[model samples]
Target chain A: MQQSESQSTGAVGARSEQEPSNGEIVRFDQVVKRYGSNVVLNELDFSVAPGERVTLIGPSGSGKTTILRLLMTLESIDGGVIWVNGEPLSHMRRGGKLVKANETHLRRARKSIGMVFQQFNLFPNMSVRKNVTEGPVHSLGVAKDEANQRAEDLLDLVGLSDKIDAHPTQLSGGQQQRVAIARALAMRPQILLLDEVTSALDPELVAGVLDVLRNIAQTTDITMLCVTHEMSFARDVSHRVLMFDEGQVAEEGPPERIFGDPQEERTKSFLKAVLENG
Target chain B: MNWDTEFAISIIPQLLQGLVVTIQATVIGYVVALILGLAVAILRRVDYIGPVVFVVFEFIRTTPVLVQLLFVFALAPPTVAPLTIGISVLGVHYAAYTAEVYRSGIEGVAKGQWEACRALSLPPLRVWGAVVMPQAIRKVIPPLGNYLISMFKDTPYLFAITVPEMMFMAKAIGTEAFRSMEAYTLAGLFFLAVSVPSAVIIRRLERRYAAV
Candidate 1:
């Protein structure tokens, strides 16, 4: 199931990962991003292997979400290139010179990646079925019946099959977030970007969303990059957890090593603060 | 000079004929305004040409409808029908205001809504046509209806183009019979009869839909 999803989406987005490139699904090479005078990401470099679940944990404004946003091409990087599935997203090679990508280039390059924002960001104008089906039908030009069938499967996977016709406004925050997850997956993104998916929910609602995500993480071989404040979710769902500080990776290891054992002072301080409040 | 019952009775049938023209002008003029206004609003979102469009919108909006009526009437070809001239004048004038209405409506949709469409990899055309405009136009329907009613009342300004709408008929009757009170009073009554209910219905619609 995971291989088929990856194969189908690989055909949709850009140059497919059918050609091997050393097993890296996503790579950011010396990436620099800035907003006015505030540097959000400075010389950041990281790579996620295909089918690995990586979690980035940090305090606010540590530039973790910025990394996800760059991968999604929601914002362009000021320096360096972002390569997804071995294709350049930030710049295209034209006549052996790197040039900034135009709109068409960016759109095509970004199809392999899907993002779930902190806010649910579901289409308020559409029903849950349409919200999930819209991208496949329009962007992928998939047949309506085929797209509808896939939407049903995804909605069922998220445990919202009963609310297919419900509008986004009619659903609870957690339900809407689940619908958002289904919508992103319907595109069959090879690498799913979860940007603090459970951060916006109420305490009770957070657990439901987390459970759905945990199931996906365990079952799918899709590469996953998540940024979250929920330490338990990070520990449970992630293959590896990276502690981020001031726009760089401070420490990273298997979740057991990062969470159970003490290492760097900054990582120790962040973990202590988060646990104390909880 | 007084409310002459005899003069009022004689002008009633002629005034009714004039009312039909008034109604036709208002309806056609509004369709033109609505389409043109929405076009200008949507087209102005393009970065390369947006400033030029906004300048043109401001120019048309700052000018008076009466002045616009006279200008279009004077410049129109002799072969054109007077009624078409009248409708076009009103259409262009109100379109300026309605264009602003559409701009505010489109912008009023929450920023997150746009980001969702973008993240879905929906093209720009699909984003605006399928997602953004649907929500925006729903919110602006009441305001759009208010402008429709305003355009209906403003049809009287068509007298400059000699289309013989209700007000033109009233003035012509007053000249011939020298009974301004009776003819003008009846015209006001007809306008009152149409506009009051239209306005109340529009207000009710605003309350019903705009609250959400």
Candidate 2:
């Protein structure tokens, strides 16, 4: 099933460079991350299958966002290995030795993954169309005309076709985030990582961005690993939900099972607090 | 202090010729400074050589420009022209200062911009040239213009190395006439004429980019 799904998306570009031995698109085997003396992710283990949608829910310091940051290579892991498409991400094979990856190796490994930041990190120096087209033309070697056309289509999909020429500073927070979404999708990545994508928006503007994301979830076969505070959106889009506590998965199951009838004490208390505050 | 109107009027052609030399040195030296400064700024970010580059630039920044001009002039071969040596020395000296200005501008860019570039898997060259440089250069334009004006004023230092710049011509006129008042006052006026307008332009630029 994963093979056929990846092949269907391969028509956009050369995405089948590596064939996964297992069906998992992303896997962490005993991964550990630290900031000084603080251990953020301690022997964490999880996996996401190809085309699967997974949401990580936890309190502020529970290491949910750290998982996404590690996958994107924004922060390096102190121990263990990360696998993407069944290939080691944090290390590379050199004369039969698994050594830490260099810049060139990391660049090759990062091609299949894309991330949407919470701050909607659009290039303020460029127009909306150029922001979306830049990665495709420069990184993937797509032709200028084709990248421009694809950018237009993406802007239309995000319901911002009229804003193709506007600067990011001119748009509202929600509009900027939609443009960010378009920019991420323009790369044709097999795995998309969303890190509290709508956390910085005004209260009234959250629904519009969520609707755009819902549209993408329904339409594409791309694998999504999302860290979000919106519980209803998580339950609506996620196939599985993981409740994290102290850098470990406390409970994991279908959304209906985890949210409806949580089994762990930590998960129960966490959900109770969230429900009351929300 | 008698003002010599006729003497000052007579030396206009010579002063203009010296002014040409001064303007040439400032423009060429500034071009070199802009390029070398950006290179130094980027090299300072490299892990192994960053500290070495920082110490070398700090040494240059602390010393006097006149001493540097003399040191290079003494070491250069006789085959090289004094003007050539003077221009090179001035360029390298100001590069140390401009490098600091560029460092602040580069650091001023938001951290998220870099993460976005990495997430898109954009190459290092494209990240700097296409995205980072454009934003960094825009924010530093006003400070860069101030450096240009400052470099123009500093051209008088080249007279010590016998570069025959404006101040050199003024001293020659004073010695020939046996009166220092007219020539010295004209030289001061020339600097004011160029610097005041440049300061105004830089102020305007600061206001415009500040709004962005």
Q: Pick the DockQ winner.
A: 2
**What's the lDDT for all of these models?**
0.87, 0.91
TM-score of chain B of 2: 0.98
Worst 10 residues of 2 chain A by lDDT: A11-20
Q: Give chain A TM for each model in order.
A: 0.91, 0.92
Expressed as tens digits, the lDDT of each residue in A167-232 for candidate 1 is 999999999999999999999999899998987888899988999999999888888999988888
Error of 2 at A5 (Å): 40
Q: Candidate 1 chain B TM?
A: 0.95
Whole-model lDDT for model 1 versus the true structure?
0.87
lDDT of 2: 0.91
CA deviation > 4 Å runs, candidate 1: A1-20
**Residue A140 in candidate 1 has what lDDT?**
83
